[model samples]
Target: MWKEAAAGASPDLEFRAPVDAAALAEAERRLGRSLPGQLTALLKETNGVADGYGTDIVWSLDRVVEHNLQFWSPDTFPGLYMPFDPLLFFGDNGGGDQFAFVLTPERPDIFVWDHENDSRLWAARELKDYLHRSLLGEGDWYR
Candidate 1:
């Protein structure tokens, strides 16, 4: 289903090995929150997804853990932008902008975090919508 979602948009998308349940559990433990169910299912099918140009459309489990940890840490940005505690960043646009899921209220919608101005805006309805848009469209499709 995960592959089909992207393949429906582009056949050239790349994929990495699937992550095991244990690893996902560890990641959740580290983040102090569970990953969205759709995302977890996708990770179980493939650890990550990338475009033909090697851009990470969906980051691997390890990168997911590390990136979110950094974003959640106060020392990482420290007044440069809004607190990242409410977001769980997953991938990037290869131009410093990133994609994430809102965790505070636990919503399924996907949003783009503009790097320059630090604005958070709705991008897609859910993971599948995000995949189709991000895979079929160019770098700034969300905008």
Candidate 2:
């Protein structure tokens, strides 16, 4: 389902091998939280999604775990930005902006975190919608 959705958006997307259950479990363990169902299913289908120019539209399991851990850490970010505890980052624009799902309310909607302005705004309804928009459109499609 994920691969087809991505391909439909753009055949140029590069897909990595599927992540195993053990890797998923380890990722969850390291993050101290369960992964979202759509993200988990997508990772099980393919570890990551890359664009033609090598941007990580959806990061691999290991990258996902590492990035989230860093974001969740209070010391990792400067006091200039808002707390990242409520966001589960999974992807980024080629620029500094990142995409995430809200975990505090456990919603499926996707949001974009603008690294420059520190704004968290709605990007898509869910993972599939995010994929279609981000993959098919150029630049910050969410805006």
Q: After superposition, how far is residue 16 of candidate 2 from its true place, in Å?
A: 0.5
Give TM per candidate.
Answer: 0.98, 0.98
lDDT of 2 by residue, 60-81 (tens): 9999999999888888877878
Clashing pairs in 2: none
How big is the positional error of residue 134 in model 1, measured in Å on the Cα after superposition?
Answer: 0.6
Off by over 4 Å in 2: none
Off by over 4 Å in 1: none
